[model samples]
Target: MDRGTTDRTLLSPERRRADRTRLIDGVVDVLVIGGGVTGAGAALDAASRGLSVGLLEARDWAAGTSSRSSKLIHGGLRYLEQLAFPLVHEALQERSRLVTTIAPHLVRPLPFLLPLTSPVWQRAYYGAGVALYDALGAALTADRGVPTHRHLSRRAALAEFPGLRRDAIRGAIRYWDAQVDDARHTLAVVRTAAGLGAAALSSARVTALLRDGGDDAAPVVGVRVADLTDGSSFVVRARSVVAATGVWSDDVGEMLGDAAPSLRVRASKGVHLVVPRDAIDGGEFARGASGGVATAGGPDEQRPGLILRTPTSVLFVIPWGEQWIVGTTDTPWRLDRDHPAASSADIGYLLGQVNRVLTRPLTPDRIIGVYAGLRPLLAGEADQTSRLSREHAVVTPAPGLVLVAGGKYTTYRVMAADAVDAATEGLPGVPESRTAQLPLVGAHRWNAVKDAAPDLAAAAGLPEDTVARLLQRHGDQVGAVLALAASDPELARPLPGAPAHLAAEVVHAVTAEGALHLDDVLTRRTRVSITTPHRGTESARAVAELMRGVLGWDDERTDREVAHYEARVAAERESQRMPDDRTADAARLGAPDVRAAV
Candidate 1:
């Protein structure tokens, strides 16, 4: 009943404790299972609709597919090939809302170059398609700030990006799409939901679907939860339950003894590589591609991100701050769901595809990071997972239970609205979704904070770029982070090993953001894992030491956390060396999950 607490927006250890107590004690209007983008979005949407909501995550937010996406917020240009026009249009609208209204600080436009290898018909076909794509975006929303598509000559394409081989193509088409730090975006959604009176907690797993009389065929009433963090178990009562569990959707169906799946979600593994900006061409790309700052002016105007048509799916060489993200092999995967390992073969496949256009090839030694994520695709008569629909399905297989599956990263808000609509279909007088107008935690004062960066940097005795990046990552919340740095002189300096991030940020991740472990802070909260060459290994112990006091960890616990992280990195390295998925899965499983049994 009391929603006026200052700690509501802070996902601190204290808040987690309080929310867990509240979850155990009270019956909520809606209970959401999952903490990825869609689940977090649903929580924010439902809470803003004036519902008492409970959000539970078996792990940290976006720990799975959400964090490991291609990180693009677009209408899926390739979907046009499938003629999924309505899906494209809906995604375009959501993309506009994210850029202009909801998360300008987090989501902004980035340009891309689509090379035409066969100059004549290829140019006409792709040029027309791209023109339609741009027109669709413009028609849906007035000037989303994404530039219109432009035709480029062979010479002009080389001028824009010299990464392509000289003899590779005839010309190119340049267009715009948005990019985001997906993990942070998901965390912001969670915080925004918490601020709106949703009791959100992570590292909490639902072991069973609770029934009133404990009958197998009885309608679901609540859940039996296991706290993965502390090894405690509890019960939760809710009027309705929504499973946005993604690839794990079928597991939810099994809990209710439902033989039929409302939404058949097949796991399609998408593997990506993070390499230095120079790796594309090695020399010319180093000079041009690393030009722009992230989340602000965007990646280099001349050296736009590349979209190459693979024999299977589209491949992207998207530019980040100092690195380039080259990715995504979409093949059916039937391996471990928690950690989808990228095998040497997957790596070879991606490298082999991107190398078709590159003047200089990418080698394993040049890779900074490797990650794999499973896409929850709707099962269809089509054999290939790529042929599966991007549109989501929501259904109530049993009374008081809702399952949502099969959607992409860009349209999570829409998916959330639909899931909430289905979950509360019988509940009278529930208001329509208010999330379209709502901005996440850092979005509110982002514009003003961005403009004040130089002054804020000077005042804080930090570099302008550092301040700007902080503003970009935390949005209006930069002030809170700055306050932490000002309080202690020692925390103001750059972190050891990972100089791009401040020492204060490691502290803030726990105190304000809901970072329960080293993995949460380094991997999701800051992206130290993917950006740094050592993949957060060199920075592990130091980060743990910074968080030790805040998390009340003794020397043993601190050392254990560091050990788990190092082991995780080592296991990932071994996995990447493996030639196939089964071997990679076994290698990755060498290091057990940091979380204990429930």
Candidate 2:
């Protein structure tokens, strides 16, 4: 009955080693390499379908592309411009599924405004387009929880959004989409996979693939893994292998020694800048559109992309909890694939675009947070990365190896399903996937429990706001978090510098979420480092203490963690100030991770 407190040691080093041992001893049904949203989803899918699954990641879960998304879970309405109806429809369906069924707490609806430059024709045009978007959602989920689109005159638009530029808009068409905390969502999927009996390991790097039978073997029988935390190497055998690595997909394919499986994948870098809440005054779902509004819906529709005035990007801003997150530039990137640094040009481009329509201009001093994510664009024609398809492709050149590439974040679940389906084709006794109806680790009956939690909130001595925050992050498992605090009341205290997060969360990340280092906790688990002005300095010691018990860190280890964290923050700060990518990359590399002692 208390499945809520499942005693699975998901992130423990000992449990990870034991799981790795199990895979080497008995062949796993599927071995998933990569820990982003798609790979994490694949692990959950395979395990839920009764396949013995082993998932290995070189770094922490969602530490790569998954964590760096624009954090929206919506159908690609822009794809409609390219006449990519199937992709839009599929993404719309997945977005609805995530909000209504899968992880409602983590994903919620956000309203977007398409500011019309011309009232009459544009309103009719965009209204029909958004109507179609709503229709697609209806077809996807008959009772789509989101409201339909609405048209507003210029005067009405300005009245609702006083900060808007008077001349930039003719009117506005507001429509609904969804947003999510990307890293949290990915972490949830990985945890869900572990709960479904998948052996999950982080800080376990896959160095190479070991072919079965011979060098020219038909299927990849196993992978050679190096435990990065310790200097040890081992082999993990599986009946089928899936490479769900995002931007690194092509490189992973290279390891398999086959003619690259014609995946047109390219990495496009997108950046989001986080600013103080004082920078924007608007609700979370506020939206505005521009010139292309009227032409968006017709059969021969082709219009200039409408700008979303997001934090530091277009001045079209929305309230995100405590801060205003702005930006997102869709520019081509040619650089080292992993850890794409935001170039000065990229930042300048965003600032220029966003400042154009803002009543008050934002200078570089206003920036408190900056993150760049790579969109894995399925590559396309000469000089056009934007034109590349967001559609996904799965190719199996060899029997044991499967590669999935090129899909939007909203469609990760769909992409994962397809990847697993292809990879598990030859696996013995693999049951049909049941993930469609299965709830994630923390999500089962969440709504019902959350609806009935006022008494529980009072009993736990938590304010309503605190209870709501806990339920948002932990879903139906808030009771477990409460129990953590019950064992030690200190866990209930808010993190020193980060009032929004509880110390219990930092503890839980280590105990359950596979956060191996302090950076993992600060940067990914809680996001205190990026969102705060001190970048988690004041809270580092507090969080370090929370980790000490779970990770067996001595005083010296804790000091080193804190020192490394400080250096990392300093380096990132320096990186952003640099004038170019070359300088930025160098600045970022100034703080190398402290390697485990030999």
Candidate 3:
């Protein structure tokens, strides 16, 4: 695509307003509610099938469960123990597609080591399971896009992961899975959908479902949406509507009243802690030093990510830049959906589980960031959230309305395809999903751009590492970002308090990524909020000032935006100190939302 064509497809400020106007003035074939992976995927799928699509989200894209995933694109290994063969097969196929075709730039291979606590039985048990996992993947797709699992001796494993506790395990099993920057991948899906003629709008919430007739049995036709940005309300008409709202599926069902869907969605909160790479002695193992077993950290030996089983859930210490993302506690959460709080107890639990295997125990002081998100698990007789199925269900609660719930992050494309299929049930001539063969916006020319990273870095007067990072994050779209910096030298400078990102990224976030608020740019677009120790407060003012130029914000609005971001950071920190969910939720609620203030 030409520069102008690509720029026109961006979720820019101008494009957002234009799309919103067009959506209100005319009816579309499909209207997708929710900006998370599933909804974005659905929009792309529908638009690819020659359907007129409009996607709306109450907040920024991937602002919910989508952004808070474990960042893995693996078939649930534990599901194999549960005898969920079909689910595992489906996910492995999707993972292959993402790594090989759909989003090669965003999703890549990541190796994981599962320690064997009991020498013989544990090793044999895990080996058999992993062997089956590999077999399933091979059976599903010809292009598996990842290496097979391998067994390692104690000495071999130790050489690959010197950080592992010597007494904790006898050996280990290394396997290949894929990982992604979940938020960025979701955003790219939305952008790709927009490029394919889908009208995408953020900060617009669907409040009510519009029906063809006033009766309860009447088919649903449209939605009444409130623009959270300006407190204005409008109705968008569509032939069909699909709700991929994740944990908020129940809320949308409630809006449907007595005709509500039969599905029950239970919210399970999961939390992750981000810490520096050195804290975990990451990448301490030298390649080819022992038993010829390569470390599973990342493409380079720079990141040797690890995974272990806990009493309640699996714990993953994944490599992400200079830091490792350690997480996840699955527990029932009945608190606020918008800002799920991570209590002191949750943090303590994760630290305790991870510290069991780590040579050095990580304390609260070492934690750089903590994030909590809710999963919309399908309610079943099984009381444990871990027991809930990862398979998704598509329900046509009413005619012209489809509700999709209960799927893992890796299978979002499948969930979206199922949702759209249900939405267009009776409509003739709607083509089958083409997203599996279609590459995301940045993936088309990524390989060429990656090969030219060194040249691009030299021309832009940046380190090759910086150019590589930009390529991984934006793929071939890095040119647009560099173009901004080329015209203004100041935009090339690294952002204060977040040296990994450049100032031009902040500008592009507003101009091309639909970052309307300070929170959107910091939290989702750049990840400064979860990576920096100050939770992005140190850079909030500077980023707000840069955004003001594109957004046309005056001094008063700019100041308020920065203050709101700071308050949010403070509230999140305070919440993390609380003992339980109730107290943590109360603490987090102390911060006022910028939308409400406006």
Better of 1 and 3 by TM-score: 3
Better of 1 and 3 by lDDT: 3
lDDT of each: 0.86, 0.75, 0.88
The collision pairs in model 1 are none
Q: Rank the candidates by lDDT, best first.
A: 3, 1, 2
Count of backbone clashes for each model? 0, 15, 2
Best by lDDT: 3
The TM-score values for the models, in the order shown, are 0.96, 0.91, 0.97
Compute the lDDT of residue 443 as modeled in candidate 2.
Answer: 69
Q: Supply candidate 1's per-residue lDDT for 50.
A: 98
Candidates, ranked, TM-score: 3, 1, 2
Residue-level lDDT of model 1, residues 1-598, one tens digit each, is 1234335688988989999999999999999999999999999999999999999999999998999999889999999998988899889888888987798888877788898899499999998889888888988667565778889898988877877887998999988888888999999999999999999989999999988665665778999999988788999999999999999999998888743455678999999999987676422322232223333333333347899998778999987767889998999988889999999999999899988888888888899998899999999998898888899989888888889888999999999999999989989999999998788888876656656777999999998878888987898888888999999998899887788899899998998889989999889998889888889999999999999979889998899999999999999999999999999999999988788633
- Taking all chains together, the TM-score of candidate 2 against the true structure is 0.91
Clashes of 3: 2
